[model samples]
Target: MTTLSDLLSDPLPSGLGLSDRQWLVLSALPGMGARRLARLACECPVWPDGWLSRLPEQAASALRLWLDHPQRSPFGALFDGLDAWLTADPRNTLLHPDHPAWPALLAQLPDPPGVLWASGDLTALSLPTLAIVGSRRPSREGLHQAHRFGRELAERGWCVVSGLALGVDGAAQEAALNTRGRSIAVLGCGVDVIYPPRHATLYRRLLDEGGLLLSEHPPGTRARPAFFPRRNRIVTGVSLGVLVVEAAEKSGSLVSARLAIEQNRELFALPGSLNNPQARGCLNLIREGAVLTTCVDDILDELGHWAETPGTRSAAPAVPGSDDDDPMLGWLSDVPTPLDALVTLTGQDVTACQLQLLELELEGLATQAAGGWIRLPR
Candidate 1:
């Protein structure tokens, strides 16, 4: 029974060097997680050796206690298991912040993972990435929007990075792959452990399609609630920006959006009906200055890559819906006009006129404010 601790170990140092072996030892420390290791490394420029010698009394005591565990010790089975896992496949590779193959943006995270376990093409990480995330249970429209954005962005050569959760996240990444476009799935658990179980097929598909799957945790680790939010940081960390399609007022996606803003990465949110409970989180983001994205242009425009980029991969202005071209929509003015006024002005049945107004509203060309619907700048 190989445990995660063993999988993270590198006892014999056969194919491994001393530095990586030290890192594996650090990984095996029960209480010392990424942040503590990062802090220790920063506090002592010459990590591992120098830092271990001078570790504070309390920290050293904790490490000693962990070493006392029957299953953990001077690395025997742990290292053996690790070597086997590494040599099991050519795609299996582990990276740290110092590695040249590590994603540049990811290395900039406040507490970057010291060990990034991955499978598939590591170079694909160099391509600009856009993250798409939302609630695990999203509305139909939300799912549709996520897939549309994912496919479009991926087709334009941007890699779609997302937590491998269901609903919006899965929809987007799957759509990207369906189009034969590249994507990256950041796992909340080990790259080898399929948390959802149902996504077992999708998980293999991702790697089969040359998509990258990454995790900070070692193989054999199971998904935990805390791990998902922690995983969200990496999703946003590796992306140029994060696009939140739909989330509840108190959803985990909101946490990612805040992390993106804190990380100084661009934030984009898709607006939904005020009546939708799932859309409230995105609505709050829009209120607090996240760019409201209606199409790929909304994102590319904000990133300043739309019109100027030269290649087969640029987005064009969105085509206006035929409903927006109706004469009734032209009757709506920038000023708020009453429904009765609109009905009389358009000389149509109340329902017919309302339907047209709704069409224009969806197009971002009109909005109901003050007393009535008003024309809005597209």
Candidate 2:
């Protein structure tokens, strides 16, 4: 059995062979990626055996003068830091392709991350995963859509995957976790470093509740613009499919959608109002042949052949007789719906809406959430 200590201690087989440590060493290099390794392989069919052994003086993903100066290399110091980071926590894991725990889906990516710094359950990476993503500032309807999709998908035993950002990503992942389902957070920064800071509680919940945080960046690496696109690829690549709840014409979520299409992974999007700017991306995607999703079953039915969605939820039946039963049940959901939004949705005056909500709350049919109110799941 390979242990953490043996991870980087192992040596290469022969002159032309590569060791797992060599793989980690190469991965730690800045700008280094699978494509660069591929290019090197073409030149030296037996790589690292000769010119590719360490950081080269000239390469697409090398900083020859900065870190690989002729006098000294930062490789040893970097490994020392990484080893310290690994030892800091028992849950911390640095996974390479050689590790049996590596996600097989990631290996099929065009340029897979050579290493991942992860925490929590690694086994969740093997489960049927669904990527849920969208704009940072979405409409109430968009938020509701994300929550419903995530909850419903998770109820079916699918592990929800997302970036853990401020909006739809957070809403969806939180909803999935609320269902007591597994989830994976693919971070642009390190797994230990929470990007938004606002999601601190969510981050902690993820680990405590058997969720996982995955990162290509080593611990202490800060978030940057370039890192997100890389993160977006993993979100789509690791999942059986991606569902875009809402995204503007130009948004980071669209990047994931595009990557999903490029990878030939199933892409699903929830259609929003035609007037909504955030819906533009999903509409464009649907026009370009992405699946148009209206309900959880739409996704399950379409991806059933490829995705592993096997879970069930007993629907809560509406109460027998409120005698004065309100028509607002159609507007309520597990996701918080602001009173104003509910009023708009139900075409009712504020006073009447509040009264109905109070009645539902008294009947144990609704509960207050941070935003306003949410229907108790049946």
Q: Taking the candidates one at a time, how many backbone clashes does each contain?
A: 1, 2
Clashing pairs in 2: 315-378, 316-378
Cα lDDT of all candidates, in order?
Answer: 0.72, 0.72
> On residues 1-378, what C-alpha lDDT tens digit does candidate 2 reach at each position?
111122122121112234445566666556556656434433434443453454454542343332346236556676777789778877888876555555545534557776788898876765667899999999999999989988987788888999999999999999999999889999999888987999999999999998999998878889998899999888887787899999999988999998987766789998888999999999999999989999988886766432233233223223324432556866555545455345435554344566687788898888766545667755
Score every model by TM-score: 0.72, 0.71
How big is the RMSD of model 1? Answer: 18.9
Q: What is the lDDT of candidate 1?
A: 0.72
Q: Write the per-residue lDDT of candidate 1 for residues 1-378, one digit (tens) a residue.
A: 111122123121111223555566665665666666656655433443465575666555544544467356555565676688789988988765444465545434557676778887775675667899999999899988988998998777778999889899989999888888788999989898986887887788888887999998888889998898889889998777899999999998999999998777889999999999999999999999999989998887776532132254333222235455667666565555545345434544334556677777888887776445667776
Question: Candidate 1: which stretches are off by over 4 Å?
Answer: 1-18, 47-49, 58-74, 305-378
